[model samples]
Target: MEKNNRVIHHPILGDLKFRSLINFKFNEKVYSGFEGETIAAALLASGVRTLRCQEETGTPRGIYCNIGHCYECRVQVDGVLGVRACLTPIKEGMAVRSGEKLPAPFKKEGDA
Candidate 1:
């Protein structure tokens, strides 16, 4: 974690060691994360909460279901939309950004 101490050393999980360090961008800001970790995990470890926006109201949203079952962690990757952060692995020099104009869950699917 960047000077903020976002990543914690877990007693059970042990020290989260990484094989290599990867540099990525979030909202155009440079960030560092460990390779082989999920984008959502990396971001969370670095203290990023909001991952996307609710298109209807423009409200900020973030990770909900860590697994792929829910798409709540949707983010834009390299200018592509609808990339799920929780499922997407972080790569060196990857560009990630909160989903701009991403519609609210129900609204996007026309749910009642």
Candidate 2:
């Protein structure tokens, strides 16, 4: 089925039609979501919001902006962490997870 970026006619959210349902694995748990839907949205629909947090504060974070500006919706997809879940699309067999810490900013040796 063709993918669309509308969430008004979703099957689960009756009358809200969303993109075609697709299967994906979140932290090894099988889940189904729509094709153009954000990873965070799918997780939230499935009752999952805690994706990851800042290493220093340990504060709970999820899709705060839903726009990709805030990094609160970061999650690991297929072993890659620090990815904005609100910006990534759901795909069949995609692997997603939480509790990932972003890598430290790279610094040039002896450049300090």
Candidate 3:
């Protein structure tokens, strides 16, 4: 409760009622966020900045280019990998976790 990262009082989007607060699991921990918000938004509100790590280096990566262009906020949802948290809506009881960096879906010609 001490560390609230949510911008509850913004000049433009002022005073959201937050009537439909929903609960979901992130990294085996329970977190509550407003319904209808994207998973990325919810996680941000919950003070979770590091969504995932670099594929090879394992450096922390959070929400960048929140419009879904960067793909830096990709996370696993309900056991599915490579889900764009910025685009995916947070569902009640959904299990969200930091995704493991996997190889690209398609391999290059020389790749085995």
Best by TM-score: 3
Q: What TM-score would you give candidate 2 relative to the actual structure?
A: 0.73
Model 2 spans with C-alpha error above 4 angstroms: 1-14, 103-112
Backbone collisions counted per model: 0, 7, 0
Q: What are the clashing pairs of model 1?
A: none
Task: Report the CA-based lDDT of candidate 3 relative to the real structure.
Answer: 0.84
Instruction: List all candidate RMSDs to the true structure.
Output: 3.7, 6.6, 2.4
Better of 1 and 3 by lDDT: 3
Candidate 2, 1-112: lDDT as tens digits = 4233345666676795456789898878887788797788788887776888676567777778998897888888998868888889898899988855565356557756
Q: Could you tell me which 10 consecutive residues in candidate 2 have the lowest summed lDDT?
A: 1-10
TM-score to true structure, per model: 0.81, 0.73, 0.84
Better of 2 and 3 by TM-score: 3
lDDT of 2 at 102: 61
- Least accurate 10 contiguous residues by lDDT in model 3: 99-108
lDDT of 1 by residue, 22-105 (tens): 889999988777778889888887888899887788888899989988787888999889999999999988999898777544
- Per-residue error at 56 for model 1, in Å? 1.0
**How many clashing pairs in candidate 3?**
0
